[model samples]
Target: MSKTDFSASQLIEIAKALAASGQNFIWVVKNGEKTEGEDREEWLPEGFEKKMQGNGLIIRGWAPQMLILDHEAVGGFMTHCGWNSALEGITAGVPMVTWPLSAEQFYNEKLITDVLKIGVAVGAQEWSRGERKILVKMEEIEHAITELMVGEEAEGLRNRTRALKEMARRATEVEGSSYCDLNSLLGDLRAMNLPATRTG
Candidate 1:
């Protein structure tokens, strides 16, 4: 799936909110030439270039896969709740603000919010269709980003994700669950072999 359809005004608003809240954030945008349809200039707000000048906010057209989540500076993810993105966030132990864009994404949001408990779902509801189809206002965006960046709830989710990471590590160790399963499989294979071919 394509990256989010965040406008430049929205990007600026989020950047300003993060800066005001003392959170370091980078606003990533698609390169004009590489993007389809309207140009980036048309979508971008006035003075956006000047606002981004040397503020530690990256306005790159593309980011390497998993690089942003792996970075120490990346504290949280503002995401569309795609399964791949969710897995990347979980593997990296980064908390997320789920802004799902479709029905499938809503399901993904439930996985992150209800099942995994590793991320916050923006505008999520227990019984209603969420704000997936709606365009999020600047205030809502700012609030969600801020909450995911520093809220105690987000921190709790981060801690749980870290614990899960440790558990996975232990499960794959030399004397771990998977190792024991492999050993048992090997023993069963040996037992199935008929008396080492009697002739030899």
Candidate 2:
């Protein structure tokens, strides 16, 4: 996440799209450090909270991302395409609506969309960098979410993600790829130490 923050105007745009999606969601808005007495309403479309009261949960700051993604009720994730966030979503077997903001996120989006085929991109062409340029609009966002959450494409995405999730789980188990690789590295180091001790 690395202290990334979207501008208030962008947040409003996202709110509008989420409202248009008509899907249940939990949005975590990370607006970096808040100013003293900052008005939170400025970040949302008018009556947005009220309209989403029963259907959505909007967290103003940090939230338990893994817990949310691991929940069975969570069908899709709207992510910034950060590496950790992408991996978390994948491990949770959740398909994503990717909105890459900056850095390697755009590349991560490519992996999720082009390589993994488990995510839909929100059509962000450039980094907003907390400014008021409309890189992605509400309609694009709504479309991405809808694509990731509905239809046969969505089902295929979920199945692939679930398979990846199982592979990730296996990698960390005893005698699995990750475990074996770590043990091999340790064995090499220990062998090096044996020669050093004999020479000493």
Candidate 3:
């Protein structure tokens, strides 16, 4: 879940979907003082923690997201499609269930689901910055998770993500495209500052 404001109802729905998915998961539910008048008891589906027991772990507040993504047991990611989160998912080679919220998140979602073909959409439509509630129902969320985590389609997504992971890794190496480009840029800048070459 995003650090951005999400309605209590939205939280409840997401919890229900994760429970219904029947796959083991770790959910980070941001911990803070309850919203103005909100009840913590109503934040999740009834008996959610108890029901999830051994199958799921819900961490209140911060969890080590990059570490979790790097674990081999992690099959997929349910994300808000923020740029940093998207990049983490790519580097970890995990496909995603994209639920865009605001800013450039929707664009990130499209890049993940459409251009990259390494994610599935949870059907979150409108953009919001907490001014309005954006709800993606349990069924839609579960379907997207299933799409990203099960069968042949899921394997294909994983393969593509792994390929991207390799590419990203290579881009950081000294001989890689990004490394070469940066060095080239530095050379250009250095040349430009070399106290203008003497003219004949």
Candidate 4:
């Protein structure tokens, strides 16, 4: 969830696929943040909300992401593969449909799908920067979502992600990696007790 980076047509396809798949989804669109006079009303396909009213919801601007992802109803994430969101999804034990946008996102996708074995890629293999954005076809989005959510492969992905969730939780414990690193940094700072005049 940082962003789906979907094009207009792709958004329509996502709507179609979500409806057809009969899965629950919450799509976050920053419509309120749109520039002056932008066509926010047309953001989704016509009748999209009513069509998928029972199965989906479009959050116009913001959402409590951590709460949503940690909810029992949430099964998978369609993510931009940003490290923070990726880790959050993992901590929540939610598998993902990776649609990387730019910077280290492509690399993060590899970690999610390859190294971590927790997600499936959405066929967006290149960076789309500047004024141009990568146009991920509807077919790819649909296929990726379907495969990760209901396909036979989904079971394993779900199990692996749950395992990752435990590991992430443990990492914050008293002697875990994150805790150890934090303590080490604190110790180094305390050791650096230079002259009070200079330190202050």
Best by TM-score: 3
Which stretches of model 1 miss by more than 4 angstroms? 1-22, 33-37, 52-56, 124-133, 170-200
For residue 180, give model 2's deviation from the true position in Å.
Answer: 1.0
TM match of model 1 to true structure = 0.68
Error of 1 at 196 (Å): 30
Q: What is the C-alpha lDDT of each candidate?
A: 0.67, 0.84, 0.87, 0.81
> Residue 66's C-alpha lDDT in candidate 2?
94
TM value for model 3: 0.90
Poorest stretch of ten by lDDT in candidate 1: 124-133
The TM-scores, one per candidate, come to 0.68, 0.87, 0.90, 0.88
Best prediction by lDDT: 3
lDDT score of residue 25 within candidate 4: 89
- The per-prediction tally of clashing pairs is 0, 0, 0, 0
Which stretch of 10 consecutive residues in model 4 shows the poorest summed lDDT?
Answer: 32-41
| Collision count of model 2 | 0
- Cα displacement (angstroms), candidate 1, residue 62, comes to 2.4
* lDDT for each residue of candidate 2 in 44-152, tens digit (9 for 90 to 100): 7777888899999888777888998999999998888989999999999999888888878899999999999999998888875665366478889889998988856
Task: Answer with 2 or 3, whichever has the higher TM-score.
Answer: 3
For 1-200, candidate 1 gives per-residue lDDT tens digits of 24555544544555555545555666666666422355665554566556656654655577774786788777787677888887777777787888776658889888887888877666734232431334445566667777776776767877887776677567679998978899999999988885655574
